[model samples]
Target: MKIAVLGTGGGARSHIAKLLELGHEVAVGTRDPQATLARTEPDMMGNPPFRQFLAEHPGVTLLTFGEAAATADGPVINGIDGHNAVAALTPIAGALADKTLIDYAVPFVYQHDSEHPWPTPWGVMPKLDPCDTDSLGERIQRALPDTKVVKSFVTQEQATVVDPQSVGDGDHTMFVAGDHADAKRRATELLKSYGWRDVLDLGPLVCARGMEMYAHLHSAIGFGLGQQFGGHFGIKVVR
Candidate 1:
């Protein structure tokens, strides 16, 4: 599968690394081609761990946002944060028409303070003003009516999403919500490729509200447990 990951943050990097590990043709999408090349080339060549990882798995190509989206096969995953996701994907909107889009985003506004160790306040942190009521995924779908937007992996931590083994706990589940069954199936396959063992389809895009709220609870748990506590929770099924 040819996958396009759009963004420059940890989320985008993690997805790129995971997709490469899964032996998928990956193209990183960024607004600035030269900047993306400059940023990723060093890590691909200089960073020992990244270099080793790439050496083990070749075929990951970095491209500008437009090129990546224009060339990708099937679904394209949006790894950018809520704040920049729309703008970053706007250029590729036409290309993304009628394509499945796996929207992975959390409404998290970073509020850092030296005196206060926490990155955000106790309540829910609003990353995108538009996501306060409706989620970014829904907004993206609204923007590109032809594009199938399926929301998933928003609740899981970046480390957990990339390297689930690092958690050392039980299977970490990811929730997906989208109206289209075909799009959901595509997302399920992609998530499985990324080592997601358990995934629950929470009906349709409207269910994303609950999923986003669940992320808030997860964040609260992380804050309460402190930074050192790095583990995820999963729901077990008994038949």
Candidate 2:
């Protein structure tokens, strides 16, 4: 399988690494390849530069957004910022039509006062845009009517997305939601390939609202548990 992972962030690096480990040929797509390569310093979150990651993984291809999708023979994973996902992928509508888009983006904007810790974050705060009525995943689905948009990885960070087994006993459950059953199943298969032991199908694209909203708690938990744990846990279903 040839996968196109769109973005040049920590998540994109992890996706490329994991998918490659699963024996899938992967191409990382970005809006600005030059600027991405020019980023010599680590990201604010302390993730290494995308260029460095690309060098480390020689098997992965670097590409412009359109080229990545047009050349991909398999699913295109959404690794861009959630809010910017629709805008980024819309231009490649023809390439993505009738294909499954495994979305790992999250629509979050943190707002916090300076009085907090070294890196204060109110944790995504509240945004009506990614709430019950609308969500980043839903918007992408609406943008590409023919594309099957399955929302996954919204509740986890880059590290967690790649290695679910590294967390505790690895019983934590991942989740996905999409209008198309085939797409959801494909998403689940990919998750399983990456060693995600459990995946719950929440059903329908609208259910992404809950997943997107879960970002708040995800952010809170990261800091709450301290850096040692590193936001590496997934939400599990008790029953």
Candidate 3:
């Protein structure tokens, strides 16, 4: 299966690496291919620039949003940060129509950058807009009503995409929510392919509200772990 993962963040890299590990043809979609490759420094997430990742994985192709989605012919993983996901995808709705779009975004607005949080790797987690009333998943589904949107992988750490055993303690849980059953099924299979052992579907795309809300907890964990901690931890469901 060919997959296109959107964005240049840590999540995107994780997805690309994991998809490659799963033997699926993978490409990355960025808003500006040139700017992404020209970056000289690491990103806010502390991950190396796109140029470095591309060098390491020469087999994977890179393209703009439309080209990545249209060329995929398979699932498109929205690996972008939650806040900018809608805008990034809105223009490519035509390419996503009738396609199973796995939404792995969290609606987080990074704050304290201008106010100067002292050049941290990234900004602290602030409540996202529309999160109180609507979720990123619902927002995407509404924007691309013709697309089959499945909300998933939002609750897990990106590293777990390839190393699920490292997720919490010994095979925890992941959640999937979407109005489209087939989309959820595809998302489930994708998760399983990436070594996710336990994934629970939380019903319709709207249920993403609860999943997104979990971001607060995730943020707290990140803060508690400090900036030096690697981005591989995940929350586990006892059940």
Clash pairs, candidate 3, are: 82-106
Against the true structure, candidate 1 reaches a TM-score of 0.79
Local lDDT at 168 for model 3: 57
Better of 1 and 3 by lDDT: 3
lDDT measured at residue 53 in model 3 versus the true structure, 0 to 100: 90
Q: Please give each candidate's TM-score.
A: 0.79, 0.89, 0.89
User: What are the runs in model 1 whose C-alpha is more than 4 Å off?
Assistant: 38-58, 110-128, 165-170, 228-239
Q: RMSD, each candidate, Å?
A: 4.8, 3.0, 3.1
The 0-to-1 C-alpha lDDT of every candidate, in the order given, reads 0.70, 0.81, 0.81
Per-residue lDDT tens digits of candidate 1, residues 58-138? 776657777888778867888777766776676678889888888887654555233535445443243434445787778
Better of 1 and 3 by TM-score: 3
Worst ten-residue run, lDDT, model 2?
117-126
Model 3: lDDT of residue 147:
91
Candidate 3 per-residue lDDT over residues 29-71, each given as its tens digit? 8888999989999997678878999899868888998888887
Clashing residue pairs, backbone N/CA/C < 3 A, model 1: none
Number of clashes in model 3?
1
